[model samples]
Target: MSQIIDTSSRAHLLDLFLGLRPDTLSLWGKMEPQQMVEHLIDQVQYTNGKKIPFLEFSEEEAKLAKQKNIYTDLKIPKNVIFGTLPDQLIYPDLPSAIKQLMTELDDFDLYFRNPETTAIHGAFGPMNYKEWIIWHSKHFTHHLSQFGLIAMT
Candidate 1:
C-alpha cells in the first residue's frame, strides 16, 4: 500500500504535480489542471484540521468504510460525486496551484508525523492519522491518474 505520508510516495506525488502542464486534460473528471490542484488542497485542508465537515455519517456507514477498506482501492470510480472546489483557492496558473497544494500536503505530512488532532471525514466518518494517510495516498493517486501521471494497473 502506497502512503502519501511516506517519503517516497510523497515525493512521487509532488513530482507528478510539478510535471503537470497547463493544458492537461482529465481522463475522466471535469477539472482542469489548476482546478484539480485546488480540489486536492481543499481535501488536504480537511485532513489538516483546517476545515469542518458539514456532512455526517451514520455508524453503519463508518463501519462499512472500515469493512470495505475503500481507501485502499486502486481506482476512484468514474462519475462519482466528489463535490466542487471553492472559488477562493483556485489559482491563476498551474504552477501556483501546484505550489499551494504542495504546501498543504507538506503541512498534512507534518500533522501526520505528530498527530495531535482528529477530524471527521464527510463520508468515511472518523479517521485516525493512519487512515487519513491511506486515504490521501489513494485519493492522490486517483487524481494523478486523471492527468495520466499514474497509470492504473
Candidate 2:
C-alpha cells in the first residue's frame, strides 16, 4: 500500500500560497487574485461533494492526454487548456475555502488508509484512495506552479 498525503503538511501548503506574490500570478493569465483563489477553492469543493460534469474527451483531448500521459507521472503542460468554469464562478469565501480544503484533504488521508474508499475521477475513471491522492497532489501542484506559487526546488 502507498503512503497517503501528509495532512500535517499545512505549513508546506501555506508556504506555497504565501510565496505567491500577486504580480507573479498575473503573468499566468487574466485571472484576478480573488478569481485564482476561488479557482483553487472550487477544486476542493468539487472533490469533496459535487460530481463535476465529466465529458467524453474529444479525440484531440484524448490523444493529448495519452501523449502527455496524464494518468501517469508526466506534468500537465502549461497553458494546455481543458475545461473548467471561469473564476467568476461563485463559491464560499477564501477562509471557508481554505478550511474546506484542509478538512477534505484530511478526510482523504484517512480514506487512503482504508481499503474500501473508492474515488471516481473525472477523467481517470475509478481510482483507489492512493491513486486519488497522487492525482490530487499533482493536480494541485500543477495549478500552484502555474500561479508561480511553488517550484519543485
Clashing pairs in 2: none
CA lDDT, every prediction? Answer: 0.71, 0.56
Give the TM-scores of the predictions, in the order they appear.
0.82, 0.65
- Candidate 2 RMSD to the real structure: 5.3
Residue-level lDDT tens digits of model 1 in 1-153:
332323236666677788789798889867778877888888889877678764467878876875466544545565466556555545778788877777887887666676556567777777777777767767777777778876765
In terms of lDDT, the poorest run of 10 residues in model 1 is: 1-10
Regions of model 2 farther than 4 Å from truth: 1-8, 21-24, 50-71, 87-96, 110-113
Deviation in angstroms for 33 in model 1?
Answer: 0.7
lDDT of 2 by residue, 48-104 (tens): 444453535665564455444435667655666566547354645545545555666
